[model samples]
Target: MIKPADFDFHFKPDSHWQWVETIALPFAVPEANINGIVYLVTRPMLGVCMCDVTLYDKITDLWEDQLYVDNQQHLPCPKSLTEFSLPNGLSFKVIEPLKHYRMKYEGIDETSFDLEFFGLHEPYDCNDPNMDPLAAARNGPAWDSSWSGHYEQTYRIKGELVARGKRYKVDCVETGDRSWGSRPERDNASIIWWHAAFGENLAVHFFTKHDIAKTNEFGELVSGYILEDGKVYGITSARGSQEYRKSIPIGGQLEVTDIRGKTFEFTYSTTNCAYWAPYPAVTYLQSAMRVNHNGRIGYGIQQLVLSRAYLGRNREALLARY
Candidate 1:
């Protein structure tokens, strides 16, 4: 396992309170591309709507005490949740919401007529630093690791199955809880989840969000395995793992898959994550990701490689180096 220090582990300004500014996609194509600035900021974890996860709250987790316990951290009751998504293929999407978000997917074939209701909370104020501004956006029903978050997106498009989603309805129970505990305990034990329903597979990816550092940078570690068709097994990348393959324009190419560190082929390009600057000199990291599972070669694996400097600074970088 690689340590955080391996990545240089330093922010641009290295301040507590940070801000995120977005630049709209100007060029044409499909979907709306938005550029975002992820500064070291702390804000409320509020957003679209609140959720009701009384189901898990009633249960018991060993780390309940260590969870965020301020007034805003706990909202006694859960409320109706708001669904955030890019209805028109990829029009507008939810980015770095204060707290985490959830998504649910439903469809029959690979592509054609399907729906995904993704939701999140409003981000906290960008000016504040004394507290976590990003997490201030959360609403009713305290956000707990036991409940974790949710996700809903199409696995396949035309009848082929995306490696992660084949046929399943993933859930998050222990994840949200374990997310509040220590790393060893959290990573060692997790009830992660992933759900999908497609032509050749029914897959899911689940894991616990362990704490990254006591500095409060992040109290979650994300890991899980992508189980497709009950035969293919792809373990997820641990938390704080960001792989920058190649630079593109705004809403560029993004490689999203499980199977880590393996030799495979990539026939598709990223459309959402590569953001372009006015002069093409700089670009932001677009959250949009689209990788075709049946892109000529069918599927691929992750190839980890390092470099002295690629994205400007000097350090080790991970890319789809196939």
Candidate 2:
């Protein structure tokens, strides 16, 4: 069982600790998607603490990401349960241990939100006791073991979002994910990450990690689950095939087989809401997609990230599409 203590910062001396918490909501009445991320990165050796808050608006295809870098010694590490205010008037407090979280933010612009997330499912640990989450490595020096741990859960979000002087009530399905470990420098890595949550008590999450230079030297990590009725099924393997137009992802199909040999197929289409992260280094393509699984209809997000240098010829194609 996961505890609220897992939400606390785990900064190791002389090492890097990155704690990221994110919630993504897909709304229908307003035909928009909203996502917020709180990132705290600590480097004890460097004595620095970097905090960031990112808000994404799918309707306007806009992204607002801000960063604050401070001395690690000045940043407060809450031992017990307490509210911590971040830069830009953003703060979060745990309302019900690991099951409920409340967040509020006031932006310099006329953008703000007061929201609560209620976990609908138990927390899923990406790395179990017998499994090595960072086992995917090349022949070289073991890839730094920076990606130490990851956990995620689906939630029901409720609250109000005030943007551009208008307030909109929010009631939708979302996902909360937390990952902590040393930050990997993505100079020569290629990645394919997939996440989906269906209304039928089902969700899918998986990723492919590889070296750009040696594409053959790669690993596929699967951490997916399916909930039907009151039973939870673990996805053992997932295979994905994508179609790209001018190097931009337009749509894709996925096949996930669980440990019980039950398979689910999903077909999804991408949206125009895309965001580029950290400027010229990374680009994240995310979409509020329509998903079809065995004729059952649902909605979710299809997101992808790629390093600039690793795209090669595909870079020109993506530029052309953009």
Candidate 3:
């Protein structure tokens, strides 16, 4: 029912409440000045589910993992949304949607994090047993959402971060016919684990460092152009390169070579490693995050912007309230 092109180019929200609580963009640069911190929530559930809440700081360079919300046993699990945080005690919360999955995020201090009132939504995507990334990104989920999740852990070895966590990733992908010129590029994305957080900041900067793989062969393409106004650059026009300054199951240095050929670099770093399940059954990959653009010498990060919402639904709505 939601055609990608039918959406607004900038941002669009539904009614007084927003259909898009927040979008999960891979990584891109925008003219908009995203200098403050960003609070993001992701829930994967139609039945039992798990949610990830992340706190990303722009100016100070931080992306902290406050907590992981578990709602596997509760039906229509309810959660309170998170308001962005400022170090000076200037913090806030946004009202959750009335009839959709909502989030609960709050910070009581520097040491503790909490995810209150939270609910579960049906999977925005599922995959056909035969589809791939290019197809799935374009056609939406493939199979019916049946995967659950597990606990997470992280660490590093010889500069490379090792990790394992559980969350549904793709088992098989159907690569038959895809719609709207999007069959050859499909692959599974949803990961239960990524990399370990590092540095004093505990955040991952785009391509600076800590560039590891999220999916098997589809992780390094997550860079986009950003503008000076804190506005995010579009993905169709994004390009960059990376290097493997480190070694392990997955480690490398990343760079972006846009159409202009100009390049910016950052060092990716990670620590606090551990092992667990990649999801509920498959034991192929690990999940964790590290300090991005924080490594002095090497390492890196990656992502992609598959689809987007009308910009009107983005910051304008958030800014309108402030």
Q: Which candidate gets the maximum lDDT versus the true structure? A: 2
Tens digits of lDDT, candidate 1, 250-279: 111222245545322222333333221211
Tell me how far the alpha carbon of residue 243 in candidate 3 is from the true structure, in angstroms, after superposition. Answer: 9.9
Candidate of highest TM-score: 2
- Residues 197-267 of candidate 2 have per-residue lDDT tens digits of 66536666566553323332224644556655535566667766666554445677888776678888888
Residue ranges of candidate 2 with Cα displaced over 4 Å: 16-30, 33-82, 129-144, 210-221, 278-281, 312-322
* Candidate with better lDDT, 1 vs 2: 2
Assess the local accuracy of residue 194 in candidate 2 as a C-alpha lDDT between 0 and 100: 59
Model 1, which residues run further than 4 Å from truth?
Answer: 1-224, 230-246, 249-267, 272-284, 287-322
lDDT (tens digit, per residue) of candidate 3 on 189-212: 322122212221222222111222
Query: Clash pairs of candidate 2?
Result: none
User: RMSD of each candidate?
Assistant: 18.7, 5.6, 17.5
Error at 163, model 3, angstroms: 20
Candidates ranked by lDDT, best first? 2, 3, 1
lDDT, residue 189, model 1: 22
Looking at model 2, report the run of 10 residues with the lowest lDDT sum: 65-74
Local distance difference test, candidate 3: 0.23
